[model samples]
Target: MSAFSRFTPLIRALPSTVPFVGPEAIERQRNLPVKARIGANESGFGPAPSVLAAIRARAGETWKYNDPENHDLKQALAVHLGIRADNIAIGEGIDSLLGLIVRLVIDPGSVVVTSFGAYPTFNFHANGFGCRLATVPYAGDREDLNALLDAVKREDATLVYFANPDNPMGSWWEADDIVAFTRALPETCLMILDEAYCETGPASAMPSMQALIEQPNVIRTRTFSKAYGLAGSRVGYAIGTPGTVQAFDKIRHHFGMNRIGMVAAQAALADQAYLHAVVGKIKKARERIAAIAADNGLLALPSATNFVAIDCGGDGVRARAVVDGLMQHGVFIRMPGVAPLNRCIRISVGPEHDLDLLAEALPQVLKAL
Candidate 1:
């Protein structure tokens, strides 16, 4: 029963862990069905009908491997963003792309700077590469840009990960502030501006593509998962200088993009009207979530993302109880893992029926506590 002993030192040294325990896993472990699946920040509004039609139309072509160059998707994105196709690199999702970014820049013992409790998956990628993490605590529930810069300079870090309309807590900074932060960083430090939630945030919160597209040390990542409702497709792309993005071509899996997923993304991109409509729905859902929190006397923090973080007015313990109690009623949700931030429970925007489930279960959960 002995296992093979030839794994790399880094692999052997690392503990087995997933960045997030998915809802399906929670359901299996707790032996409860999830009635309202809104925990993982997924778009419960679903993709556009055109996107579904595109998938169905292309399902017959599933046997063919996707184009390694990702030509059509890149071209479509280029036209949409008013950028060149060469400036883009496509991946399965932001998560997979983060791993690639880490591999490209990090060596054993290299320093990686990030906000404490920012995105755990980025940390997972950094740890897998044997990079030492330098974390800065959040300032006023937002990622402290000034402190993050200081950490990068202090540690001489090689890579830094930041998210706009950040996850878990759902906070964000104005676009000008972000551009200023990017300009202030050491050119030696690569910055991953994870904009996975960009489409759902305010226009002022996103820097124009022309602002940082030419910055060699900066890579902006966006996904079809949120506003576009294509999480299952796993399609995401990075925007960077042509020279910087081309590096991905050297090491990326040639056919990692799936045919159906590519089709879904392309269709989703073409249907801007559908996207705008969904964004409106997402806004309403966020309001409903906040209203639910208010009804129970909890403070709902302002969010630029698809989820709302409701302050449970207690520490992680009380927040965790509400999470567990809601789950007991088949209403699945999540919360931050660190202190202060853990005082709030994070809930993703879903359809009215799902939010209704959350609304009904939340007060009952809090009452029980």
Candidate 2:
């Protein structure tokens, strides 16, 4: 069959790719059931019981389109964060908001800055908008803030993406350092501080909301996908000055948020007791994952996130072998995409039984290698 001839140049130039393959895709491709769903940085601990109850109560309202303004969710998030509702903009998730931000600021050939091996989705969105990327390499397994700032200045970049309690490698910087970085950036460059893993990290790792909430150039993105155990809900928000966040209203999907997700996020926020409890469990699970890595004679890097990145004691080839071997045993996990970072296989925290599967399979995989 012949393809449609009419298409945008940007669409034609872009290559098809999967930034992060889901476990379901792996199952279909490899024909293996995933015994431990510990990849993709999803919370195996699951959402709070109250959140599920809220979903059930609101399921009947599914026929109605969600409020285009996202009124209630924004109000709830504002109260939760101690900020005005005007300071917030809700989206499907951080990923959706990233796309919107890129669309708002980037034109063809606009320069964007990000860590060389940071979150790929942000990179994907930048490319989709025809922005040129200026990638700064990781310094000692962590995103180098100084280098990132330097690149933004050098390239005269319009946008920059940075994640705190970073993913894949699970490294993080102190909140004070982050505040300094944000202040150091030129006002012309818009900074997206992706705090997707903040809840799982230490108190010291997260900046005070008041510190950067007033900065027009800074937008801090947060999600219910991590410690809140609501990855399926796809609810995330951006915090910035009112004038700054108002830009989203101009280009955002007016009714993109799911009704059920809004209800779940509201309930999830109200039940802080449950959130605190789950955070404790996440911390414990991180420790267990670290222990398993130690038992298998691999070094588990310090993580402020829900997952641990275990150094497999060799290069990307060796790390990949372990990943493939573990998947062969139905214990699914992932690894970093670039060098140095790729020497470590990333594992998400799950219940004891899932870790039990990992504990059983890891040594066997290593022995075979």
Task: TM-score each candidate.
Answer: 0.99, 0.99
Scored by Cα lDDT, where does model 1 land?
0.94
Over 4 Å off in model 2, which ranges? none
How many backbone collisions does model 1 have? 1
- Candidate 1 residue spans exceeding 4 A from truth: none
Q: Per-residue lDDT for 55-144 in model 1, tens only?
A: 998899999999999999999999999999999999999998999999999999999999888899999999999999999999999999
Q: What's the CA error at residue 113 for candidate 1, in Å?
A: 0.5
RMSD of 1: 0.7
lDDT of 2 at 172: 97
Report the lDDT tens digits of candidate 2 across residue range 81-189: 8899999999999999999999999999999999988999998999999999999999989999999999999999999999998987799999999999999999999
- In terms of lDDT, the best-performing candidate is 1
Q: Which residue pairs in candidate 2 collide?
A: none
| TM match of model 1 to true structure | 0.99
